[model samples]
Target chain A: MPQTGRSGCPINLTLEQLGDRWSLIVIRDVMFGNRRSYGELLAQSEEGIASNILADRLKRLTASGLLTRRPDPKHRQKGIYSLTEAAIQLVPLLAHMGAWGRRHTRSSKELSVRAELLEKGGAPLWNAFMDELRHLHLGAPRPARSVFGELQAAYEKALARRARYAQD
Target chain B: MPQTGRSGCPINLTLEQLGDRWSLIVIRDVMFGNRRSYGELLAQSEEGIASNILADRLKRLTASGLLTRRPDPKHRQKGIYSLTEAAIQLVPLLAHMGAWGRRHTRSSKELSVRAELLEKGGAPLWNAFMDELRHLHLGAPRPARSVFGELQAAYEKALARRARYAQD
Candidate 1:
């Protein structure tokens, strides 16, 4: 990312850093999927991001300070990537974006469950989730509340409800 | 703008719809710059967006139902673009984005004033701003409060302060 944006406009700068479709997807995987390795990010991606594009985005994200890459102790050839504080702070932005999409777009129930939970849970939930993320990605002490477990349980419950409704 | 996203994830859907750099910029201009006509949107753009990119984004945004383009009454050859209810509802999203960018990025004081105000003012202020936007763009009954005026004044004051600091 460029040190200077097209203009000093905050929105423009944010867009410049993370406005593309792939960058946030990478962040989302790190945050939600816990896919820290390049292979995992590549193979587990539902969006089917191209290998070259994924490689480019990882480099860009690392350079932009949203991600940090470190050598994996287990394998000299492999590197493990982790979210930096900057990327962890994107929870609210991602939550709001997810909320907007759920309300406005042709969203799937299973896919949108997280967004619904985030919207209903609001800032308190978001803060807890971010705290949990810091622990997961940054080695911080885990919070007493597991917002991730709460969110995942909610999502799984919604999925079960949808499965029942589908049978009916 | 495809009907289906790469995945059904709400965040991915939103990214697919608006993940590009220029789409939101076009929206920002129409919403804040009050540049209703194509010419105004083109000429007054701070980012100097290319004409082709602008044309493409306008078409994409209109296709996505974020904007409505109608023949200008004053100029038979010109079209005036207005925000739909969907776009107006984006005030909160934009405000949060601006706030995130202001804190995380190297934003300028003059440019970030609006974001600062939105952060300080929160949802009540966003609702008022959206109401004012609805009045301006959708021809709704104008709200008595001038949130736009208030925001613009804050931006101007920030600009003046920057100018003074520059002189110093």
Candidate 2:
């Protein structure tokens, strides 16, 4: 298919394909939160993505080969969304974006905890997380390490620290 | 200033602030092309951003601390734009995005050369480039090594290669 981009510049093409406010968020929800259905994505999103926008982004992402859609075997009316390998590979990019935001923006401690750990863990952790994601979303063999568990533990620890600080 | 991001999640915050098709492109032009004036940005842009959108994004970027705008000493009626520390920090994110695009999307050889070099050069090159940008835009002392020159040279070589291929 002819690429529908403003220009052939790789960055511009990427932006054209997934540069909107909602596309990567949809991918993030699917990849990180394991929200496989539209309803799950709509209800669980922290960013309050509108249903219409979510619908549009899902179609776009699926068309762009970043996501795959199939009828839910458990419920035919609902479609299940899963990340393509392309979307799964975006872990590093999202990790870097999260790290940058944590440093430069006024982010919430709880919300930014994952980004901090990702930054601290660097690419090795990112690769491990991607492996876990593949197992979850693509039926791949699970990696030996649980980077997700490590990240969650770190976040919980950070939250506990914040709570102690609040009391002090 | 209170951040205007949609959520405290670092990725969501970054996207809300700059997930549009044009915001990062504008920053990229200012950072890479050294387009310091509005007319220069508008006229030299490959994507043909509408004037109203450019104006609005410039205002938003300035407000969000990604860009600084100043009265032009050469022209009283016009203004000069420069990347702030926040924007200079976006180099890695943009680079990764570019690299991903080159891998997954149809991309131009000449346009993707910078991203290729960035992937090859990694953090040391990014740090050097950021140091150079700080000196150029923020009055910091210039680094002895010119990462910018190296990137420019790579782009020029890629363009020449593309030209030779086109002729053949």
Candidate 3:
């Protein structure tokens, strides 16, 4: 991110903030997997994000106000990263991105299952998911909707299906 | 980009397609500015994209199936570019991204005006805009809604407002 010198398009501004592949990947991990600590994010990285890159993205996201880092009370040195309201609002955009990818890419059955659910679930699901995120990351009241649970269950089922297919 | 071995998250796959800053900028020009020719895109660029980068992104986008290119009938050697159905479907994601930028970044008022309209207009406007994009880029029958017109008018109005403010 450069100094705030832009007087240009909003999408360009957004691309500056999020165009880096790793930034959104990190955000996805946090948003979906509830990976907060650096260790959790690094350990669970499906794309094998490098340590230095993860560190830099975490710093950048914090600086960009998409995330906030607070010292983990359980550990002196560790930080717990939480999504801000702005990032919570990204549910729809993420849903759209996922939906687009599932439709267009050679995405795997197991991985794309979530996107399929999101596309099927639409705005109501996205909003419910956002409320859930707010509860998880921002201390908002817990919503009755369990989109996160549903998405996780779907992913697990797809994984099982892939496993059975692989055995054949 | 790396030959479709990915069996990962849809957002990651989508990010692989769209994480580049220049690609979306070029798409924005085509979608919003209606700049199909390389010459037209180069001349009207607000962010001063280099010719080589633009050419390369155009080639990549065409190869990636988000855009298609055909030799301009009016010109011997020049080519005209147009968005594919997949690209047209990106309106909602682009709208969300622009809205996020407007909310979080130092985006100028005149530039962010379009984002504001999209955010306020929401899905109906985005669907209308997509229909208009389909009409322009895919030879679909022209829709009754003219979101493109409204966005263009709003942008021009903002530009005039900017010009007036610059005098002070």
Which residue pairs in model 3 clash with each other? Answer: none
- Model 2, which residues run further than 4 Å from truth? A1-3, A157-168, B1-5
Q: Write the per-residue lDDT of candidate 1 for residues A1-168, one digit (tens) a residue.
A: 454478889999999898887899999988877899899999999899899989999999998889999999999778899999989888988888899899888888888888998999988898999999999889999899988787788778988999999899
If scored against the real structure, what TM-score would every candidate get?
0.95, 0.93, 0.94
Error of 3 at A51 (Å): 1.2
Q: Please list the residue runs of candidate 3 whose C-alpha ends up more than 4 Å from where it truly belongs after superposition.
A: A1-6, B1-7, B165-168
> CA lDDT of B50 in candidate 2?
91
User: lDDT at B129 for candidate 1?
Assistant: 90
Report the CAPRI category for model 2: medium
Ranking by DockQ: 1, 2, 3
Model 3 C-alpha lDDT per residue in residues A1-168, reported as the tens digit of each score: 553444467888888788766788899999988899999999889888899999999999999899999999889799999999999988888889998888887777788888888889888889899999999999999999888899999989988988898899
Clashes of 2: 0
Model 2, B81-145: lDDT tens digits are 88898899998898889889899889988888888888888888888899999988898998999
Report, to 2 decimal places, the DockQ of model 2.
0.79
- Worst lDDT run of 10 residues, candidate 3 chain A, spans A1-10
In each prediction, how many residue pairs overlap at the backbone (N, C-alpha, C within less than 3 A)?
0, 0, 0
